[model samples]
Target: MAGYSRWIKPEVYPLLAPVGAVVGLMAMQLVRNVYTNPEVRVTKQNRAAGVLENFEEGERYSQHFVRRFVRGKRPEVMPNINKFFSDPE
Candidate 1:
């Protein structure tokens, strides 16, 4: 513990507990999902149904708020810089 002070900063100590708690919660949820979630327990009979479900999920995710907003905008890399250089004086 004493040697840890030399490697880890004192400022970071407060952040460690919250980060550990979040990681612990995520791990517990993962375990619970593995045992109780139907999506995890796929069978040969319902494999096609699972594929359809996945496709629908994909469509929903693709139509997400952020994706919808960005989709309407131009697909540009550094549009401002390009505009500035492209402008005629």
Candidate 2:
């Protein structure tokens, strides 16, 4: 332990101390930006809205197809051809 401390004192600590402080401050700033930045919040909200809009569009298209073809009854055979190639195991 003493030898490790001695090795750290003059060689490692002086070089690492300031770098560590700067890195710590940078990490704190990054966390603060993620938590408090308005631009980041708006971008996140826009991305979420885009995703939700895409999902709703897909749902509406599927519903329209189901209403047209399947009506109120379930299909006897699966409509998708790709299901045959899928691994059952």
Candidate 3:
């Protein structure tokens, strides 16, 4: 037990702990941006309702300037052209 104490740096570890925490938070944000759905939202308020649009009015938008080679060209427009139904009132 005495020998193990030599390897642990109680003072240094506490000081550096916050650095590790900040790095983790920044990393999470980066991932979120990269994986964010690049789609034009309809409703703007209700995302769940948009899911239903995919079949009824929504569609997959490669929606970008650079075309995809594997599956085929996605929509030329970016962010996709989302369709929404509004109340006529």
Candidate 4:
């Protein structure tokens, strides 16, 4: 490593060093924008909408699965038990 370092000219290194530093700084700013900028906010909103759509799709899938596998078993019907317990006299 030291041998390779010695081959670089001192004058040329200083000029190239700042160019590399500037490039690294700009790359950090680009990464920061992905986490905190409006573009990211919009992307998050779109993702949330997609998740809600998927949830509805999943509900449908579950209903289909139960109907196919349960063999004539239906979802239990509510007995309107609340009506009997309420005071009405």
TM-scores of all candidate predictions against the true structure: 0.43, 0.38, 0.31, 0.35
lDDT of 4 by residue, 1-89 (tens): 68966877677877887999999999977775665443343565565654243456455544664477776754545435655566455
- Ranking according to TM-score, highest score first: 1, 2, 4, 3
Candidate-wise lDDT, in order: 0.73, 0.62, 0.53, 0.61
Q: 1-89, model 1: which lDDT tens digit per residue? A: 98988999989999999999999999987886665455665566755565344666556544766778888677888988888899956
Best by lDDT: 1
How much lDDT does candidate 4 score? 0.61
Better of 2 and 3 by lDDT: 2
Candidate 3 lDDT over 1-85, as tens digits, reads 8886698767778867799989998997666445544444434475565444253232234332333353465444542333222
Candidate 2 structure quality by residue, lDDT tens digits, 31-89: 85665543344565565754343556455544664377768655646645545566454
Error of 1 at 53 (Å): 12
Question: What lDDT score goes with residue 29 in model 3?
Answer: 60
| Model 3 weakest 10-residue run by lDDT | 79-88
Candidate 4 Cα outliers beyond 4 Å, as residue runs: 2-7, 41-89
lDDT assessment of candidate 2? 0.62
Backbone clashes under 3 angstroms, per model: 0, 0, 1, 0
> Candidate 3: misplaced stretches above 4 Å?
1-8, 37-89
Arranged by lDDT with the best first, the candidates are 1, 2, 4, 3
- What local lDDT does model 1 show for residue 66? 70
Best by TM-score: 1
